[model samples]
Target: MKKDPSIMKENMKWTLAMDEVFIQALLDQHYKGFRMDGTFTQTAYNNIINELKEKLGIEFTKSHLKNRLKTLKEHFKESYDFFRNGKLSGFSWNPFTKTWCAEPEVWEQLLQEKPEAIRWKTKVINH
Candidate 1:
């Protein structure tokens, strides 16, 4: 649905200024990924800001936009060891699968062999 101009203005007033909008975008990109089909991509930071300008009628450049997103990632990592290990899927510890089962298997496979990670995680989880 198209936002009414007056309502859009009110939303803008309540929203944080550009650059400061990092955390939400970072989390959104990490978790939400894409919303408008494939408008968002692996290199989506620039596209997202450009589209946001059209959607929100606010302007931001690619460089600063990326910087803001990077800072948000840094903040998230600094605050959590789970994120440092790239585990941000937010699952309760399952004794049967000590690892975050909420995460996709491919995500756990990034560093080591998939089967090994699964086996190790399974043991830790049960141990």
Candidate 2:
């Protein structure tokens, strides 16, 4: 069966600026007590959605924000593990460049074990 075009929604491509705005809005809500027990309240999500709409002129649903936040958290966890866990040797984070740095051989070995680490080598997350 063919899907109805009007009911079908295209995936939203979140730009870096949009991500930054969303994170800032989330942090603002968190500081205002919108986050409790390690999860944001529904009101917090609404507030973030409104903020994003006003600031970025983009309308985002709660699901969109939630999904993006989930992806961001996953990236954060991976970065934290690789840089702070100390289990992997020869990996150092460069604050100035906002990227992970290591010798060529070190990266080769790390890729063998965790190929996902390559994405963060140059991709900088403001948070």
Candidate 3:
């Protein structure tokens, strides 16, 4: 059976982090800066985890942080000309802003390039 392009495109939409609020907070905090270094830091990672435990009552792992950031970056690529390389911090680190700016654009041309059915779907928290 042939796959429906719309369904395939919709599925292409990356799964949302289990803790989206926390993920968004992390992105807003760590992924938005004009520096010459990677956005994520060891200190920041620890602090964020501590904050999550205290406020959200969740014990997150280092792998969780990495996965959430990757998913967030995937969303940015849907609307922007984003690039990344290397592992860990190097994955989403944009050398230009020295942070995690996606260089997002709202141009109709670019948006038109994407399928209309594309959207995000949150996954249940397994952690």
Candidate 4:
């Protein structure tokens, strides 16, 4: 039996969407490297994006995803701080430390978030 190319394309679309909805751990590893504790500033992020674009033979980046997620994080942080500490600093710090002290949870969260960011920047969000 043969399949239509259009049908195959449509199926692929749904498959990719589902993949993005769920987290991909392998890609998540890429995000972990961008961890903020001691690596990856904004400039560095841009450089990484450039390299990825070259490798992927396409355009777009995790920076776009970061912008959107940053918005979500900022709002949540403000709400949390308002209730917990009555303040939300605009600045964000990597919660991780050398020994799982300050930001262990943060590091875990990054594993999820970074992959989402890459997907969003490359696929979901448009320029």
Candidate 5:
């Protein structure tokens, strides 16, 4: 069966500014006790959505925010693991470039096993 185009949702693209605003809004709501047991309440999500719309002039749904949060968490976990794991020792984070710095040989071996990690050489996650 063919799907209805009008009813389908398009992928949401979040800009860095939008993510910053979203995180700020989430933090604000968290301080207000909207987060409990490591999960955001519905009110918190609503507040974040409203804040994003007000600040960025863009409409965002709870699913979009949740998905973005998941992606952010995944990236954070990967960075944390890469640094914390003893196998990847001798690497330092470059605050100036916001990227991880290490010997060429170190990166070469890592990239062989995890090619997707190449993004960290260029892109930095601010959060």
Candidate 6:
């Protein structure tokens, strides 16, 4: 299959330090029960920015945060597995909750693999 240019662009922009931080924040929110419906709220962006500053001691600009979120939403859309009829899907956005959500099994699989850095933070999430 041919590669998607947009996916390539987003993939190239992802830095381990920043992207991993975003992923971990989402996982943290998941454990907090804030995403019972698999939907992660817009508040996650603020949480990520705060955590990044606290842990990395670097300030993350709002523009960068907004860009990351835009890329993430595109990722969620592309990651979905569609059926031949284009009906079956993996994730869908919830406008009311301002979140992206997927079926439990798909969500589990998406999160099962962890970045090495975030893996250690599981302890923090547990507490």
All candidates: TM-score: 0.33, 0.80, 0.43, 0.27, 0.80, 0.40
In candidate 4, stretches whose alpha carbon ends up further than 4 angstroms from where it belongs are 1-27, 30-32, 38-60, 85-127
Q: What lDDT does candidate 5 reach at residue 72? A: 84
Assess candidate 2 and give its lDDT: 0.82
Off by over 4 Å in 2: 1-10, 85-87
Please give the TM-score that candidate 4 achieves against the real structure.
Answer: 0.27
TM-score of 2: 0.80
Instruction: Give the candidate order by descending TM-score.
Output: 5, 2, 3, 6, 1, 4
Q: Model 3, range 47-102, lDDT digits (tens) per residue?
A: 77777667666566656766766766665663233222323222244444444322
Where's the lowest-lDDT run of ten residues in candidate 1? 118-127
Each model's lDDT: 0.48, 0.82, 0.48, 0.39, 0.80, 0.55
By TM-score, is 4 or 6 better?
Answer: 6
For candidate 1, write residues 2-76 as lDDT tens digits: 655553332232244443344456447657665356344645676567556665677555554555555545544
Root-mean-square deviation (CA) per prediction = 13.9, 4.2, 14.8, 14.7, 4.4, 15.6
Where does candidate 5 stray beyond 4 Å? 1-10, 85-87, 112-116
Candidate 4 C-alpha lDDT tens digits along 13-121: 2233332422232244446664466444565566545654455433434544355345545745543443243222221332342111123454345436454322211
In candidate 2, what are the lDDT values of residues 1-127, reduced to their tens digit? 9865432354568888998899899999999999999999999999998899899987777878888888899888988887774456897666787777888999889888889878866787566
lDDT of 5 by residue, 1-127 (tens): 9864532454587788888898898889999999999999999999898888788887777888888888888888888776664346667777777778788898888788888878776677577
Task: List the lowest-lDDT window of 10 residues for candidate 2.
Answer: 3-12
Q: Give stretches of model 3 more than 4 Å off.
A: 1-36, 81-127
Candidate rank order under lDDT: 2, 5, 6, 1, 3, 4
Scanning candidate 6 in windows of ten residues, the lowest lDDT window is 118-127
lDDT of 3: 0.48
